[model samples]
Target: MNERQFGPELTAEGASFRLWAPAARRVDVLLDKPHALRRGDDGWFSADVAGVKAGARYKFRIDDEIDVPDPASAFQPEDVSGPSEVIDHATYRWRSENWRGRPWPETVMLESHVGTFTRDGTYRAMIDRLDHLKTTGITALELMPVADFAGRRNWGYDGVLWYAPDSAYGRPDDLKALIDEAHLRGLMVFLDVVYNHFGPEGNYLGRYAPAFFTDAQTPWGSAIDYRVKQVRDFAIENALYWLRDYRFDGLRLDAVHAIAEPGETPLLGDLSRAVGKLADTTGRYIHLVLENDDNAAHLLDARQDFPRGKYRAQWNDDYHHAWHVLLTGEAHGYYRDYQHSPLRDIARALGSGFVYQGEASAHRDGRPRGEPSGELVPIAFVSFLQNHDQIGNRALGDRLETSANPRAMEAALAITLLAPMVPMLFMGEEWGSKAPFPFFCDFHGDLAEAVREGRRREFAGAYARYGDEIPDPLEVSTMQSAVLDWLSREQPPGRERLALIRKLLSIRQREIIPRLADAAFGRAHAEDGGLLMADWRLGDGTTLSLTANLSNQDMPLTAAHIKGTLIWGKELTASMAPWAVSWRIG
Candidate 1:
């Protein structure tokens, strides 16, 4: 591991505290009493607090005036406003000795938020549900951001502390135990990390070094100033800290487009190089996935000399938007461009890897967007029907089963899970849970009111158009409403939906996973009445054909030479019924 003197490091004799407060005239390490730190070169301060060890709670007094949490804190027991707790990451005994990380293609990502995944909303509570995911054929668990936010319950994207795990979901060891237990169950754990901008509240970096954030305006806030050496190193180190310290298999960088670093070597590029080196040193399969809205495919291209590229996959919002607009027939906001051609968009995304790819986008004011991604592999895109942003950001936080046409939703699930791209399932999506995953937070004072009013204003247009009632973001009931009813998975529509996903995923593993490595595989055909067919060329000379009628009316099959035993279908006839999804190995 790259040793950086920034946080509390415990030794046998005493604990050494270090912080970067270049602007401060004096810095002091405060545990029970104040111990003055000697200012070092380049604006760093250091102090060795005698008899202070792991489990010690401490804070740094900057300029002997402002008290703040450590920028590289490992655990924050009392939330972000409290002092940082020293944690010994090596104390926990891991049971994943025999486990090597799973391959990229074998990954079936289940994106979950710890706060609302269960009734308890704790890390240990999440461990009890791991067996269910394992039984459902999921290979990886992708957790949303867990860094310390301002309050008790949050979506985790509003995190300010880069190193500390949120105290609301148990301690640092509890999170480690969850990951350790997940690895023992043969599941890879991936964490969704936010490096674009810190949360609005409980952030103290600006107090110490304002250069940490740049003047560039992002959708969220000021972008990080990557041109500064310390800021760049800090971002890169945070990425490594998660992978190395927490034992997470991969990282999902949230919204890379919002990160504006206009330098020759951007923060993303430096992260790739550092992470790639860590993967080589540890001999572990570490991957980086991105949530870039711009459809930047060049990030995935690993040169012959450098194996690990910027990212392995990116969340394919184009595919989801196309599928969503087609299924619901509602195109507003960014979905406007897709209204013109939904099926064509889906076809292009399925075939060539990106729908825009330099084409003129009506949503972007007719500006040419995206780059050609035809040469990229299919797995370069991470496809999903319902993710956290798509569902939680909605007016009512309704699941696809309740919001869209039922049959269309089923057919959409079939295509999404069976597609060559890596498929991600929202928590409770497999069973079609009726619980609403609304946007909720527990902020105080003006911040809380701001969040509640902001959500109401954001969805005001949808409310006017569809008569939708936006949920109160500040209500405790809103957060409670998002919790999954685990018992519902065994009953009625949930059971049926669970069966469908299980069957499709099983078939995907047997039929699709083997052929995914082939660069020449995965082609698609779209027809009228929302009829779509995908063909995956096998190594031997046969084609794996999948047909689906996404419309509400029967559609005729046009393929003439499709002669093979039916793998999965409600009807094996000349014409497909409404919402009929079938697969054939020819």
Candidate 2:
């Protein structure tokens, strides 16, 4: 494992602490008594304290002024503003010592939020639900950001401390135990990390090290200055910390397009190369995914001549938008871009990787979006019907199950789960839990009011009709409402949905996974009356085909064109019923 360049390093005698505070004239480690740190020419402050041990709580006093938690803290016993706790990573012994992780092609991801996954809403609480995911045919458990953020509850994007696991969820060991138990159950865990900007509050880097950021701005806050070597290393080491210490199988970098690194060696490529080196050393399949709206196909291209690192896949928003428009017929916001011809967009997404491959987007006021991605392998796209942003960003946080027709929703689900692309499900999507995942946080005072009013302004359409019915993002009740209802799985409708999902996933495991290694896009087309047909050439020489009628009206089935044995959905017939989907293999 790569030695962490930030945070405290433990030895037999005690611990050595280091902080990168270039702008500060004096820096001190606040333990039982103040210990002055020696400043280096490179702007690093270091102190080796003999008595500082694993459980000691401390903070950094900069220029005899404000006290701040370690930017690379291992654990925060309180919240982001509290003292950082020194955690000895060597103390936790792994039960799955010999585990090497599963292949990328075997990934069937379930994106979850720890605070909303269960009523208890802790890392240990998530362990009990592993069996549910395993039986549901979910192979990878992808968690939202867990970095230490302000207050007790959050959707987790507000993380300020990059290294520490949020104390709101559980202690460091509690999170390790969750991963340990998951590996034992044949499951891989992936984490979503934010690198573009920090949360709105509890970030004090500006006070001590203004060099960390530039004048550039992101949607959330100031864009990080990755052009600086220290700034670049800080982000890179954070990625290694989660994978090396927490044993996460992969990381999904949230919104890489927003990461403003205008340098020859971009942070994305460097970070991937460093991770690739780690994977080479450990002999583990450490996958890296990106959520880039730019749809830069070169980052995912496997045939690169240079040593610049490549990503495993990208979260395909095009697929979700196309499917959402087809099922619900909502054309507001970004949905308007796909509403013109949703069936054709869906076909393009399924056949090629991106729907907007160099096409002008109406949402961006006719600006071009995305690069050509047809040559990339099918597994390079992570397709999903619902994710955290699609569900929680709504004014009411209403799930698609509450609004869309059941048959249409089912058809979308079948296509998503069994397609050549990798599939991901929202936490409660399997059993169709109707719980709302509204945006929630624990910020107080002016920030709290700002968030509540900002949400209202963001969804003016919904607010105009619903008026005060929109949930407040700063309220405790808002967070509680997002909790998954486990009992729903036992209900008749839930049971039926779960059975269909399980059956589709079972077929994927038996018939699809083994052939996804090098699967390539074949072709896809859309006809009038919402009829769509698509197929792919599997890693083996077999052909996998899909035929669906997504409209309310029935359409004639061209059975002669689809020459394969039935694998899922209805058998071949003269005409396809409304919202009917069929899959075949030959």
Candidate 3:
């Protein structure tokens, strides 16, 4: 493996190519002309094409019959269907040389889809908006996946070309420039990667290597065969490629619960170890986060050595679901369990890392799920009220601000930012941008209609009343509607909401960040009249208290222990207003 490199490795004279296709009897490198490749050990093939340099277009031919793009292509200049272009990754002049990156505990991540983040939906355009993110108190920019997919616009989870940066965004150098600019501003960039399954279209890997996928079913498609050495190599190397070559600070793996590992040593566990080692060699602080619905605590276990354990955090759906149900008062589908006791779920999420720890989930057909995560640090959980899945997957893609309860939205903002755990904000969420981030895609013909029908069928069970309201995923308007109106931030409600977010972030940095080490010392307790209270002492012995009234009426704090000057509130009042939140420091 060390002797041969995958993809096109260009030198001054020519480029060398290597591919793994165990099923192919013959493989050829397709340059200006077809060049036959000599077989290597372990069903691998290699060839050195003279006069083929950087910027050259090429593909690989299998058994002199089938022609396809390089599976490890670094830049798909013509989207997914066109030939792959050779990228000279080392040529980019990076300016973030001094940037060492931030730790996970300090990560205030702002999640954004590249295509919808800016009006142009390109890397350069998004870079123009970095100043806004930096000023908003974001430490990291979590970009939705950029891997080349089948169309002009997508959420990027349908990426079939694993290595290439989508052409719709920009060229390979353009992406590197985006990361370089972000690092120069002292903001670490984290990419969201989908490894659970390949997209339904434009994937050609199964033709060359059928063993890459297993019969195990995933929500997206077939599960990856992680037990196979080559499959593991592909996944892990892709991770290191982004971290080492692209200079990303971290990665947020999407839907890792769908990743099925055949052995005790899980795919994530191995990848974590490899990334840790890479961090050591590069002398950079790289973090890994997971988006798993199962609340897999073992992934975040710090007790185990480097590779065996040590993911920085997991996206906490428990906290979001609790907040969502409480704010909206909607009890449907998976939210049914939380409707009974939303605050209790919130309290459990605050006190421990998991709300359903070792408890039977009625939503999962009474299956016992999750283990006790009370021993984990508060930063182990990433909390948010709005994210891609929470908002875009909705029937109408309405944001939290669209709900009738403004006070609850404000309260949700307060708790999300002030909590001891790491906080994430979806794009345009800070100012409550009116744009709807609906589920949108760009597959054509019969595939397009199938996607539309499948999406409606998905929500038909939970939101039957709004079945017809669900937008077609394949329509171009659906994607266009999700684009943010950046000008809205200058207006009335947008300006007001932006101010609130800025204030919350400012308070969090000034008060919460300094007391992160003491986070585990906090406690959550509820009071009468739908009041919730959480208290903790800072390093300076100053007690910071958060009181929230979830009910639709004023509630007085009757606890004898409550004695502090109100530090954060809309007005000076003895009783908390409906859905109001107050912060007190003593």
Candidate 4:
């Protein structure tokens, strides 16, 4: 482990530094200036940087090659096309000393892109908004991927430089400050990361060394060459850098199904194992959230063969698809598979990890995937009514809030927040934000033109509604419309509805979270047109049930079996109105 910034000395006393070079054969460590020494055995070259400190720079000398950036460099302001530098973790005065993570099962996630969350579009600026989140009762904040991508702006799926943090979100310290403040506010931070594929433009993988990517090609581009030893080491090291150095609580691995790695130990397992080991040493939680459409629930649960599994959760897309189809009634593409959704489907995802478990799917042409066996129930299977892809994939980039009936939106919101699974609130979904989330980019010239064509093609503008072509995604207006306007619209109906959201989340935190770990799901019942209810059994023989009526007319249930208190309501009236919910404690 040869850390940069060690000038004359041999070994770093207080700090630990490591790099991955499985193909180097003989890795050597060298001090740049007038130092007259070379590295030796242990497979790792060393140096004592007692006299030296951060800001000084050096790199990994592999085989007969010259200095290269540390495989886990945090700040590469010089650009991945240039050089890398050392960053000190102790420098950031994190105020989260008293903050430990909220328990796993009690998670209520909030997802938002850094660029659209605020006007400034920087991490430091977002920290000041933490109090607003705390009031909303969100236990965790899931930031979209911030890994190095072409320029500064992206969906983060196109990130090319795996190790470097993007410059647009302020310096590396700015992100640290944001995470530190989030922890101080008792909010866990989960960063979305792209390891599936690298972006096409500004990508220098072929320039650095030829072995970075292999013959495995994906829709985005050439998939990373994980079969090679150094490629695996590079990716594994990047995973550790975000956890061990940056102090991020967890990671949402973007599109693991697209990433292909065939090895003695699969690369996904390798990455998970490395993170798990680092978490054991740090006493801090490092959750790996893999995004898999396959619905393999065992990844979240601990398995006997894959002992290194530390997957905390995966986004339950069925919950969103069903909720969206029912609310918006727009059936196209993958959303086509989901038919007239009953409220029972949402309840199923909330209670069980998945809704399509062994069920015959008209979409897949066969029975869909199943969830994990009863073990590892502690892991959270997150569900939502809307997410980035859900909203942005729409032809108009319209969120459900923008199009769905307000009553329907409120019903979706209530079901999402109160569900047994961990809930997620998409940005702007809270205030019923009207801003559109169009697929936007800032790439200039030919790159910009290429992006526009690719998006329109991927969007599959088959509908006759848009005759010739869709507007270019590279337009500034698309990005402009994506920004969240925080100024409250609470003068009229917005006030009570927004208040209801906060109140519902508050009830969820205070009431539902305490016994969230218990898997004893009571009966979940819903009608064909109007209402949905799930009865959750608390250990004390007390039943907690969430009931909602989404129809235009008031629904009065005369059932003798269900009885409880009025724990929450989406409406402002004294009585339970249409589209209202009650968290009855029976």
lDDT, residue 123, model 4: 90
Best by lDDT: 2
Measured with C-alpha atoms, the lDDT of residue 237 in candidate 3 is 88
lDDT of prediction 4: 0.68
lDDT of 1 by residue, 231-318 (tens): 8888888888888888899999999988887845778888988888888877788878999878888888522223255788889899
Candidate 3 lDDT tens digits, 515-558: 66545637887765688877766556777777788788878655
For candidate 4, give the lDDT of residue 99: 56
TM values, all candidates: 0.96, 0.98, 0.96, 0.84
TM-score of candidate 4 versus the correct structure, residues matched by position: 0.84
Q: For model 4, how does the per-residue alpha-carbon lDDT over 1-586 read when each residue is reduced to its tens digit?
A: 4323221222355333444333455444443542322344423344444454565555555565555655445656764434555556666776777554555666778899998899989998899789888887887899898876656567666666666677777788899889888888888998888887877765644533557778889878887878776677777777777775568887888878788766555688788887777766656655667778777765775222222755777787877887777777767776666665636666565555577776667766765655542233424577788889887876677777667898778777877787656788887667787777877665778988887777766767434476444545777667777888677545556566678789888877777777665545566667755667677666456777777776677776656424677666542233346777666776
Candidate 2 segments exceeding 4 Å error:
301-308
Candidate models: Cα lDDT each? 0.83, 0.91, 0.84, 0.68
> Each candidate: how many clashes?
0, 0, 0, 5
Q: What is the C-alpha RMSD of each candidate to the true structure, in Å?
A: 2.0, 1.6, 2.2, 4.7
- Give residue 303's lDDT in candidate 4 (0 to 100): 21
In model 1, what is the error at residue 106, expressed in angstroms? 0.1
Better of 1 and 2 by TM-score: 2
